[model samples]
Target: MKFPLRLKFFVFASLLAVAPLVLVAQNLTRLTRDELRSAANEELTTVATQLRTEFDSTFRGRWLTPLMVIRNAIDSDALGVSQKISLLTLGLEELPQVVALQLSVQGSDLPILVTNESFSKRLVQNGLDPIETLTTSDDLISAIEGTGQFGRPLIAQISETGDWLATLALPLTSTIAGRQVTMAAKIDLSVLGQLVKRHPFAQRGEITVIDHAGRRVLGEQVELLTTRSIVSSALPLIVAGARADALEPYTRPDGSAMLGAYAFPDWFPWAVITELSEASAYAVSNAITRQILVVGLVGFAIASLGAMIFARQLTQPILSIGQVAERVRHGDFTARVENIRTGDEIADLARRFNQMIAQLGQRLELMKFVSEGTISAIRKADQDGISRGGERSSVSVIFTDIRGYTEFSERVAPEVVIEALNCYFEVQTGIVNRHHGDIDKFIGDALVAVFEGPDKEQRAVTCGVEITEAMTSLLEEYPEYNLHVGIGVASGEVVKGAIGARNRMDFTVLGSTVNLSARLCSKAAPEQVLVDQATMKAGQSKADLQFNQLAPIMLKGYSDPVQTYSALRHIQP
Candidate 1:
């Protein structure tokens, strides 16, 4: 259910390739089946019409010959009653379909002249008394008279043996004798059975002729004739007088599925239905469906194979990039994707990833040159600090200047001055760091720094004293250099930040605190440390430190004289 991208792409491509072929096969099968059904219906309808035409012509020809023979005998003056009987007998013998011929006075209950002695025998065999049934049968008399009145042939009742016979009666007018008589003939209808039997409607098909009462008149099945009603079954469309050709499905008596095509003949009160097994009718369509299925399966297989190869080619570079990215995630910046020459988006992405890795390597190198304190300040600036602009904070500022630094630089070589400066800075930096002070910057021969947090003033004073002791030790090691340091400590509020132009900036402290510290450094003598009153009071708790209050002096840029203190040495207990 949860297929990967490659498999999903392959399946979709296969379907896209095979869909049109499947559609074409389906449409072709449907159209062919429709055509076959139409052709079958037309063939059955034509056969029904032809059978009806033949039945009409054959039965009418048989009926008219007997009628002419009776008329000729009645009109012949030379023929007596006995002679007329003989002539009618010859006519009846020649037309085997004519079962009986009779002559009766118009209103008489008895027929005066009757041919065919077998007629009475046939009636007796069918459980009828020849004397009473023939002479007193009201239905028989009514049929004969009604035919004469209507001037057309009429079908009589079926015998007990299920045979159809017709009676035709005509009025014989004897103008010379001034009397009217009727002549009637009985004809057999067994020819309809033979007609239906001779015609086969379809392959594996059965042809049936049903009469007006839904009874089967003629078909291959003898049990259906005059016994079974088609209306009682599912085929209600198979009825008499139906004018259009139609096909429908139903189950046969044996419980087999069948399709029937039916039509009503123009000349008979019966419907001709041709039935074929449903499986046989659609056998060709089933074959076509199987063929289409095979073709569709083959097409899909071919499409899937091609899609697999194509998808692999498309995703190979992306997979390589992913592996390289994983390596980089674990701090392996040296790993990179290589040998991708497709020149598409994948190639472009590989190039961008490599460029990012190279940039990371350069940034790591740059981090080594930056001091930890400066780095922390930059990180703090990124989180809302001096990086945006500047801020005011309470901090203790310390400044140290090498006494006679200008004279030392003038006399010594440039390399010697730089070497001496580096040595001095190494000793001072260690002291400041031990006291938890951040060196703001070194300006030529001067060191400027700020200390914050609790007891920053005491830490600054301790750092200043340690810096002087370290410088004294350093001077003894390098006797060629005459270097001595002076330190100043001030505690107050100062504005601290990164300031300057966009291209150049410095993180430093400004305001009166930094100014006061610089002024104290200027006032100190060689190897001495000076502090303002605020720094002295902040360090008073340190009992071992000795501080001497200096004379109040007027400092530049201030109208009032500022009080100061000189830290001499630690007191011996």
Candidate 2:
């Protein structure tokens, strides 16, 4: 079994390699999802903000400003009624978006009016003043009160022209002859339609302007303005009393899911919203996630394939060694490896295997006492060329001992005690092996194990706790044995390698850290696990494990008392 340790390592190494790829792939998928959401919010918000800005600039300059100038001039005493008609006629002709302009005096029923050529001539033939009629609505009262304000745009159709138009009323700044005169402009809906149409998303996705009441002011497919069942759910927040931005999930009238964002001009009551379906918005990131997962899985599959091949290649020699050892186990000391050659670690391993077999043959009595982990450690050294002369390295040492074993043995039969010990040993060894720990040796009722590598401290602490719990369960099963186990774990610099006379060497770890662990184990109560300051500080539990601080204890070989932490349970023992 000189190469058995390395063979097992091949399997563990495979898991180690693939675990990170799996974790990274999962993390990448999550990160991509979040990043895509953020980008969607930014893109839609930008589009909405740009449209709002365009409306602000266009309304202030081209449409609203011109009508205000005409309002101020006619309200003055310098301009007579005849001169005002000519000026209004020319002003209406100059602004194409303005379908008509009405200058209304608060006390006068006959108000001055001018109409664009686009306006249906039927309004005049039918004795209807289109400007006065539409402007008479209560929605324009604030604009008509000489506040110089812009009223909310209203969407309507002219019966005669059958054309959709949005109206905006721009009020006069001054009162003339003790009467309020307001200039109202009837603008074509195409004015705002063109603003929305210029955006790219308006083609692939929906883009439109919606007032506070969820009325569609400028986009196609307008729903009737109603109080109940508002069209855009985002309308409430987006068109709140104070204008603010909104980037939210929206559902279309057809119940399709959409990601939408809206923006409003400073004084405007309408919200310009840009929208795209969720599927379309995250399409690119989803593609990237699929590619990442595919590449990661493919890479993991290739890595797994290599691990199997390596495990097989390494297994062949270990199997040969196993067969020979199996014979040796049956008291046939003459067994030897016959057909293992690779001119690599396996070739060197073959020589070591033969040497171990010869040594086992020479000292059958001594070999019987060696623990399996001690044997594995020797083989690991032989396979890797690690010196028997030990080196100093950071390691976590674990010590576990059954309490009251002597008294229990005194009451029980010799065979019973041996069988009980064997059962406990089997369970304990499995626990240690699974945690990547190697048993150094067994001293009567006590077992010592060592763990190394980056996470050795945490693994050692957890192993100690599990061993304590397992002992508790085992005690219940073997109630007659009447025993409990106490365990200790400590991490620090240690000398790790084979030690003792060459003829009877044992692979072991030795240092003050080992002594501390042994002493802590002795101090532990039955069914408890104890760990040194180093283990407690460096060991972070992956499980929902809690630790309680223990008073410092003065143990043998230490002048100062050592700090400790109890890990067996949530409460200190």
Candidate 3:
């Protein structure tokens, strides 16, 4: 079946990586070889696009707009000349695309300013002469008569590396006169060279730029054609377009077999070509070819045995994973893949399988402790304890709330708020766990937890008091968070354990106890622990605890005002 070039490439690459030497057993496939070469050329064209984007983004889009605006704002022709020159020079340094920018006036042969100060000074000392270094086959005076933007490629030879540079010249004004200005910008080849140097394929790959005249403008070691034209070489292929173009692998003058040609951007006449070695491109396949030869040398009589050994070596990890998966299906969570070490996808699957089994084991252990029915209830409820059909039970409720949570969260990033919440939960949960409290759920910036459930009896008030005191001490120790909490405690007979229908269940407390505790928590101010009269009487406190009566406040769904009190300590003056 026919496939898109990219998809076909991925399939070819996968096969090459697996059985590289298998190609040697059969006749050389021209179609497969052409596909590989096409893929390589496509990759080089992609890189060229990346280069163009980088250049445009760095100069034309981001850094040049301000300079152009300044140029347009020029009122007087006299002072604007020097200012424009300086602006152009500044543009070169600020932009990565512009290697150099020089403004040459129509009246004088000398460039008014060159962006590189060192180069400018050198030109002055040597008597500025464009003819000596940069020769215009056609005079510049005639070229600047255009009304709009006019640009062309020039073969530029610079001081740095003798690399060919892409030079662009644009008329500073709409019309040419006795005195007009022109701006010239150059793209540094050193930047492209650096990219090639850092690239993984540079040693086996080549990037070449051929100009409009079919001359070798800028590239690595590519010999220019003395007789035949680059125009003749590229014109017919250019019509075929972005991915339809083809390259014939040819032997270079240096006797190296190199894949030729790549893509050219429509914006410019220049063609970018990449040449890579067949040996290096298909190195893995060549290695497999050698392995097949070795197998053949060992003798055909034992070929089946050798093939079995090879197949086993490749799939041992997969087999081990299959065994582990079977064990997990039978509830053996500890089963693990054995003696499998490969970086391929099989190894990845095996690792994920092992992790899955481990998670299953942990869940099974949780199931054992919480009872089968409770485990089923919790799983069906999700993380939030929202379920139907609430019942009544004797449950002790506690609420720890954060003061100024809204303002605090707003002041920081979302991630920072989450991180702080995690740290706060760790400390709060540790205190609850120590007091044998079963955490119900978090409600915004507050936590709702319960004491004396299932096994515990008659110690709800003591546990509740201990949790509050412990949390208060923790807040004082960690002043970095600037945290404070209001805790409330209440005890009463209500629906405990898992509440809701058989299909849906929540491990939470309901009835008046939960409602009273929540109301008391809301009444407490920052850094205060407020308890309802029920909880206070149940605690049987011995420590010197002071309480101040707060005004009666009406609550939601309650007809009468509830009497509230704030826990406080008096300081003797």
Candidate 4:
């Protein structure tokens, strides 16, 4: 009851092949996912650093200095109408970022100097001359008449003007009143808009500054803007009349979620708020995820392919040994293994299988002589034998070949010919790889590859068309070679696996589908791609291309000819 030695080896090889594929698949999946998250986090951290630096510099350099100058002018004994006016004007002109700078006297009817005639006229037009009304506002008078600057930068609402402004009320000690007077410098709301507008995410997000009184000091009050009284929310969060960064998640008018960071500037108790949309701020993460999925699919495919190869290598030898073992069990000692694979377990298996077969052949007279039986047995027993393991996913495939390689190769020297072929393949290969395509195999001057595989779930037809277009541009880079390529594409469930005898295995595809596609390649004109109906159907919406139906033609092995189409041009990616 001895089994053939070849059969026993084949079974052993099958077991070896199957075990590794499962392990390889698991490792590949874990590594790919982890790398995806790491890359995304790094990008986000870089963006945050940039935002922080930009905000710090913009506030200190542009808004703070002029405020101090206006405060000093009002407190000086030497300050007269002319000197105060000169100081305010100088400060305003020097700091273009400042919208208003002024000095007010204690219990006096007017500010000594107000920069910008337009603002002065606005006050005059409002029925209170800038020079006359400064004295009547009891709050202004009270603030100024103090021993020192009465109040710090108070982000308060000025009912006189409905617009929001950051006001710094610095008190000045007046010798005349035996008390301090207040000098106020205010910044307009438009400044925040200008600053936030510079962000790449600004269109998707916004920034807002709110004052101690729960009034917006900078940034527009969009419809979704909300306020929790500063006395209620911020007072407890800060030191006694000091600064702090208070953050919270808020939603904008358009329903986008935002992250707000608040900072209180000293000159004005106005809270400077920087807000970024949750989606917009973390968009790079999503992009990274997409990139990872693409790259992962590729790695997984490569791994899966490698696993299958390993499986076949492992299975073939064992299967061969098994057959020999079965034969020995039947007492056929002379059933010798032929062409036993060299160098490894499979080689060892081949040797053992040969030994058993030799014993069987010597002991029994019922064995059939097979050519390369032992080598074939070991390979069959090798676990890394050809096997199918893949999930059905939408993917892109591109096939390309030289249009005139037959004529071109004849003219070039064999060395030069090989060099040119390698050069052409190398350049084109790099291009396809960059675009994330998996190299299938090459046939002389032709290439076949897939995209959006275990790595990318790309639209195969669209990618095929894109590669076609891209290749045209790429071929131009190698000016020395007047090369033109034709491509053909058909995407379906094609069995992809390692196929061949023993150690001389090749990763390739089976099923008439792939062959039919290759045949389409032959029919295509120079620089043209003959895509099958299946590819065109998949790419209907994704590709921007022109197409015309080619007459049904009979393939050599098939009884019925299949319908095909010629893709004239590409439309999109």
Backbone N/Cα/C clashes per model: 0, 0, 8, 90
lDDT of each: 0.73, 0.75, 0.59, 0.57
- Candidate 2 pairs with clashing backbones: none
Best by TM-score: 2
Better of 3 and 4 by lDDT: 3
Per residue, candidate 2 scores C-alpha lDDT tens digits across 14-35 of: 6777678768767776787688
Local lDDT at 62 for model 4: 62
On the 0 to 100 scale, the lDDT of residue 499 in model 1 is 75
Candidate closer to the true structure by TM-score (higher is better), 1 or 2: 2
lDDT of 4: 0.57
Candidate 3 lDDT, tens digit per residue, 409-503? 88878997788777776777776777677677877779877776643322444444454565567567766556667777777776756655766
Candidate 3 wrongly placed segments (more than 4 Å)? 1-24, 27-45, 48-70, 73-82, 85-89, 92-111, 120-138, 144-149, 159-161, 174-178, 186-189, 219-222, 225-232, 235-247, 251-257, 300-573
Error in Å for residue 35 of model 3 = 7.2
Global Cα lDDT for candidate 1: 0.73
Q: How would you encode candidate 1's per-residue C-alpha lDDT over 451-480 as one tens digit per residue?
A: 999999988998898888888888899866
Query: What local lDDT does model 4 show for residue 375?
Result: 30
Candidate 3, TM-score vs. the true structure?
Answer: 0.38
**Model 1 stretches astray by more than 4 angstroms:** 1-18, 75-78, 112-153, 156-159, 175-180, 219-267, 273-287, 293-573
Instruction: Point out where model 2 deviates above 4 Å.
Output: 1-21, 121-180, 203-205, 224-233, 237-240, 249-258, 293-573
